[model samples]
Target: MDHNISKHISGNFNQELENVRNHVLAMGGLVEQQLNSALDAVNDSNAELAKKVEHGDYKVNAMEVSIDEECTRIIAKRQPAASDLRLVVAIAKTIADLERIGDEARRIAKVALESTAKDQQGLLGNIDNMGRHVSQMLHDVLDAFARMDAEAAFRVHKEDAKVDREYEALTRQIMTYMMEDPRSIPKVMDLVWSVRSLERIGDRCQNIAEYVIYFVKGKDIRHTSQDDIERDIIGK
Candidate 1:
């Protein structure tokens, strides 16, 4: 009877942990959707869509608060240690990243709403491509978190470099456009801000990937070199 009671308690604790994790993932999904919608608004020059994205940020913020509270409750009630402790810490940190990503998305939407540039000028296409890359990075990192796959997280970390390069290239192009035509400066400046936001989103995704590694290996690999991170995860 004692063993049965102990087992039941353990099962309940595990369920609580799972619930918190699911909430974090759900929050990530909402942030991803918000980002995609913001990007679409930029591409289509749709103020209505931008407004919708802005409004959706509230839901993301609420999810962050909910998941955070649940994590705190589990930690206090269950007194989890070892791997379970790591899991909760990771979920908390990842949710923070997700919230910041939502902020970046909201900023992008604001830029879209303010932008008056209707001409494609090929800049929108470039921005769209960059947005798609970062979006995929977010999706992949979230999948890694769901599966707790350190290898997958590492792969996503590597992809961030490509996003950085794309951001730099886009900035250079926008600068050139502004110089060639001063009348385009205001619109190009808005595009620059949007690009910067997308770049920051990539950085946030990489941070989540680091959290995945931390959760899996009990190592904080935030500032570690790429080669070292690869060695650490692969060696394990």
Candidate 2:
């Protein structure tokens, strides 16, 4: 219902477009699982799980390549116009963002592999909380995409601010740890990088939310203020 692909004269064309959309959702699900596992690996200091996450990055990359090819084929074969074209373009952009998010997840998992001492586990608590917040954002944005709901996408866009605040707080905490005992600087820095990855993942999720708005509303809301995004979505 969200997509108007059924309006096409050729049933095959409709099925092709539907297939592309479904593949994108499948890729999103894979990225979500990767992110959650990476966060768990960090929280539990499970090096084996972290390694699995790292190895799984190749699968995400492969999915991106495969989806990009499918989109290109659709554009060439169907010559889709208007909203159909917008849907394909948005799918392309969304997959690219999802691929980057996977890379960030891999980076976060590496932190667990490098710094898993018992003393440093205390710092992971905040990261765990922030990770959950970001994970929910990704999940919600993907749901918005599934429905082509601009309002839901805008709401997810607003959530990036909260993630930013959490990142700032975590940075301060890491700095405190470093200043209190210079000996822990190296290990603390590793945690800092993991927090940074989570922050970047939040940013990537926001980008995908923007893509959803672009597809549904036919407006590019990137680099716009939150108030402007709300007005644009609501006005439509």
Best-matching candidate per TM-score = 2
The lDDT, on a scale of 0 to 1, for candidate 1 is 0.86
Candidate 2, residue 197: lDDT: 91
Q: After superposition, how far is residue 113 of candidate 2 from its true place, in Å?
A: 0.9
Residue-level lDDT of model 1, residues 94-131, one tens digit each, is 99999999999998887767756556449889889999
Per-model TM-score on C-alpha atoms: 0.92, 0.94
* RMSD list, candidates in order: 4.3, 1.9
TM-score between candidate 2 and the true structure: 0.94
Q: Per-model C-alpha lDDT, please?
A: 0.86, 0.87
